[model samples]
Target chain A: MFYLLDLLGTLAFAISGVLTAMNKKMDPFGVFVIAFVTAVGGGTLRDVLIGRTPVGWMLDLNYVYTIIASFILAVIFRKKLEKLRKSLFLFDTIGLGVFTLIGLEKGLDTNLHPIICIALGTMTACFGGVIRDILCNDIPVIFRKEVYATICILGGTVFFALLELNLPINIVYLLTPAVIIIARLLAVYYKLSLPSLERK
Target chain B: MFYLLDLLGTLAFAISGVLTAMNKKMDPFGVFVIAFVTAVGGGTLRDVLIGRTPVGWMLDLNYVYTIIASFILAVIFRKKLEKLRKSLFLFDTIGLGVFTLIGLEKGLDTNLHPIICIALGTMTACFGGVIRDILCNDIPVIFRKEVYATICILGGTVFFALLELNLPINIVYLLTPAVIIIARLLAVYYKLSLPSLERK
Candidate 1:
């Protein structure tokens, strides 16, 4: 089940990357590279930090296949995909939730400090888009104006709190992702965001 | 000698990052983070790719200290340092040369393909600045213009070719970095760059 969620998250992230690259007028090679980075960049960082080298995508060919599939789908249905803003947003949120939990769990497994685990979760769920935006020559939306990473941190906190309650491990995993997804979806729905400093 | 060169490279990269962040008007924390990233980002990426976990910086605190020292020096003498542009350029170029060789040697140690090793050399020497530019909300200068990474690639190719000739190991090491430094310095001196696509 976790594997399926991981794959789903990867596909969603890849599609998001493709859409962003397309909007940026990147060439085909650039689009594919961006998609691959978006799908796996966060996990790769996490794996590297924790000494889990050879990384997740390298260990499994599924991620590459999924990114390729996503790139093809996005290209074929560019117009249609653009029109499905709500669905795209949903997929992105779900993907963030799963990815964050995966990172949190990985950090936990490494016996890292709880604060570090939360940071790892946030970094894992968000840095892919950060990297993608960097490659596209734009300030990352999360860093500029979004409640995105904050939501991941919050979800991580909840995850650890629930774990401390002696909750079933499986239930904790399920609940953690659910919390992230719901938090993200609500933030989007409410147009919630962190305040930006305005220049005089 | 190699260890000293590595430390110097880290300090130079950190100084460059500090200067960039200062121009961006970031807070001290942000400046430190950027400096840290610029000093270690390339090697971190290379290490991660080659399955060296915990990364170089995490294992040794010297990098951290060097970055801190660079950051402090950059902050204190920001105006005076700006006047030392030529010296700074030389330091940066030398740093790039040594970093590229370190990456190439690491890749070769892992028995990676020659092309991959060359690419690793280029990435290790260049990606720090790329990441810095990205955080500064600019397209990486390397990708947009200059013969920067190309020099590293050229140097890597030369390193391998010389190895095939069975040159003394010490001479080969010295010669590879010398080639990179000279190529980069010449490129800058001549204002030589790859041809950029002109818009119609």
Candidate 2:
């Protein structure tokens, strides 16, 4: 189930990349590269920082296969995807929740400090979009306004808190993503955003 | 001498970051982060990709100190730096040559393919500026126009070719960076750039 959700997240991220790159009028090769980066950039960075060699995607061909499929499908259905924006958003949120949990688990496996674990979780959930925005030549939306990373940080905090309570590991995993997904839904519905720092 | 050139490269990259961030009118914190990233970003990415954990700067305090010093000096001398642009360019070119050699050596240390080593070399020499440009909300100048990475590739190829010739290892080290630096200087002097892929 966890692995399946991870693939779904990758698919969502890749589709989002395709959408963004198309808007930029990028060539097909450029679009594919963007999609690949958006799907795996964060996890690859996390793996590298943690000294996981061959990186996650290199070891698991599933991710590459998934991104390739998503790119082809998204590009073919580009016109129709407009109507599926809400579905895409839900999948992206699901990806955000799952990727954060994965990062936190990896950090705990490495016995890092909780603060560092939280940072890892947030980076896993957020940095792909950050890279995507960067490649597309825009200030990252999260840095500018979204409350996206804040939720990931809070979710990681909750994850560690649950572990402290000696809850069953399965229960901890279940509740963590639940909190993150719900928080994001509420934040977006209410149009909540972080305030940009203005120059004095 | 190699270590000294590495430090010089880090200093050059950091100062360039400071200049670019100031142009963006970022706050002090943003300036410092940019400078740090510009100094270490390429090397960090290289280390991570190669599965070298805790990274180069984490193990060596000198790199961090160099970046801090560079950031402080660059920020303080912003006005005077305009006159020092040529000197800065020289340092940056030196960084390009030295960093590419470092990356190629690391790739060889890991027993990676020569082609992959060339890629690692180019990434080490150029990705700092790539990250800098991305964060500053500009398409990477290297991807658009600069002949920067091409020189690294050619230099890396020359590095292996020299080794195959059984030249003394020290001579190979000296000549490889000399090739990269001289190529870069000539490219810039001639106003050479890569052609962009245009849409019909």
Candidate 3:
């Protein structure tokens, strides 16, 4: 079940990456590269930070195939996607939640501190967009805009809190991603964002 | 000896990152973060790709100390450095050479493809600066302005070619970094750069 969620999250991230690359007028190769980077960059970073070798995508060739498939799909359905902002946002939010849970679980498996695990979760959820923006020569959207990473951290905290309360492992895992998905959807629907610091 | 060289390279990269952050008017935390990222980003990426766990800096806290020292030195000597562009360039070039050699050696140890090794060498030499530029919200300097990564690739090719010739390992290591350093210094002196791709 988690594997399915992981695959969907990869596809969602890849589509977002390809769309961003297309908007930036990158070439086909550039589009594919950016899409691949965005799809795996966050997980890759989490693995590196926690001393996991070969990373997730490297361990499984399935991710490469998934990214390629997503790229082709996005390119073909470009116009339809352009008219489906809500759907795109939904996929992205689902991606954010699933990836966060995966990262938090990986960190826990490594026996890292809970706070570090929460941070790892946030990084996994948002770093792909950070990388995409950086590659496109813009300030990272997370640093300047929405409460994206903030929500991930909050959800991660809740994940640990419930675990501490001796909830069933299965229930805790299920609720964590759900909390993140709900929080993100609500944030987007309400147009809620962190305030940007003004230049003095 | 190699350890000392590694530390020097880290210091040079950190200084360059701190200076760049200062020029961009970043806060102290921002400066420190950027410096730390720039000092370690390339090696971290290379290590992750090659399945090296814990990364170099994480396993060795000495890098952290070197970066902190470099940051303090860069800030105190910031005014003097503005007048010593030549010296800064020299340190950066030396860093490029040493880091490239280190990366190439690491790749060879992993028995990767020669071309991939060359790419790793180039990445190790220049990617820190690439990350720095990305975080500072600019197109990568090497991508548009300099022949930096190219020089590292050339040096790596030379390193492997020399190895194929059955040259002494000591001589091979010495010549590889020398080739990169000299090539970089000459490129800067001649103001040579790759031509930018024009939009059609």
Candidate 4:
């Protein structure tokens, strides 16, 4: 079930990347690269930091193949996919929630401090988007705008608490991602965002 | 002194940044930020990888101030600095050499495998420029151009072998950067870039 959730999240992230590249008017190759990076960049960074090298993406080319497949799918159905903006958003939110939990788990496995783990979770959820934005020549969401990272952190805390309560791990996993999606969707609905850093 | 070498390198990198931003027609504020990132970026990445939080530039702010000062100086004398193209190239080569040694030292301090340390040294010397180019919407030199990264690897090996032979540490430091600069300059002079990444 966890594996399924992880795969679903990866697909969702890839979809988000393709959409972003489309908005930028990039070519098919660019869209595929953007989607691939958005799906894997954060986890790759976490893995590198923990010294679990060759990196997750390098270990399995399936993620690369999947992201490319996603790009092709998006392009094949470009207009229809564009029309389903709300549905796409839903998938992306699900991805954010699940990827955050996975990142938190990976961090704890490395015996990192809880705060750092939570931070790692947030990074995992958000950094792919950050890289996407940078590559697209847009300001990073964390630097300019969004509730994206904050939602990840809130969800990560819930994950940690659930783990501590000795709760059923399966229930915990399901609840954690659900909580994250809810938080993110609600934040987007209300346009919630962290305060900007004042220009020095 | 290490301090003087560092400042000279920083100044050189800052000048390079200014030149790049000018070519792109970036505004003054953009130029300053670009210059600052170019000068300090590699070292900061090395620090983060080695778990040195509040990285060297973050801690000193002097480095930050210096880049800003250099930026201001560049803008105030844009035409003047542009005329010193030869000196600028020499300085950039020096920066490459000095940064490579510093990266190797930091990697070794973390007790990473010697080969990894050498890789880190090359990465540290090259990544900042790659990042700068990416942000500027250019193909990175390390990825496509002359033997910039190869020079850093050669210098890092020289540094490590010197230390293994228990040569005076200061002499090793001095010799390492000197070797890097000479190698890179020679490569530049001879147009000794890597074989074409493109297939015939």
What C-alpha lDDT do the candidate models reach, one value each? 0.84, 0.88, 0.84, 0.79
* Tens-digit per-residue lDDT, B45-120, candidate 3: 8987787865676556788889989988887777777777777677777789999998898898999989999989
> Model 1: how large is the Cα RMSD against the reference?
6.8
Model no. 2, DockQ: 0.16
lDDT per residue as tens, model 3, A114-173: 766876798798888778878877766665556888899899999999999999999998
- Model 2 lDDT tens row, A96-121: 99999999998999999999999999
Residue A103 in model 2: lDDT: 93
Order the candidates by lDDT, highest first.
Answer: 2, 1, 3, 4
Question: How do the predictions measure up, each by TM-score?
Answer: 0.60, 0.62, 0.60, 0.60
User: Cα miss at A128, model 3 (Å)?
Assistant: 6.1
Model 3 residue A8 CA deviation (Å) reads 19
Write down the lDDT that model 1 would get.
Answer: 0.84
- Interface RMSD list for the candidates: 5.6, 4.8, 5.7, 9.9
* Candidate 1 residue-wise lDDT, A1-200, digit = tens: 77887888888899999989999899999999999998899888788777986788887999899899989999899889868777777778888999999888887787776766876798799889878988888756675567888899899999989989999999998999999999988888899876542111
Model 1 spans with C-alpha error above 4 angstroms = A1-44, A53-137, A141-200, B198-200
List, in the given order, the native-contact fraction of each candidate: 0.27, 0.26, 0.21, 0.03
Write model 4 residue lDDT over B1-200, tens digit each, in one string.
77777777888888888889889999888888778778987887667655677778978877887788888888889989858888878878888998898888877777676765776687677767767777688645554445787788889889888989999988998999999999988998888865431111
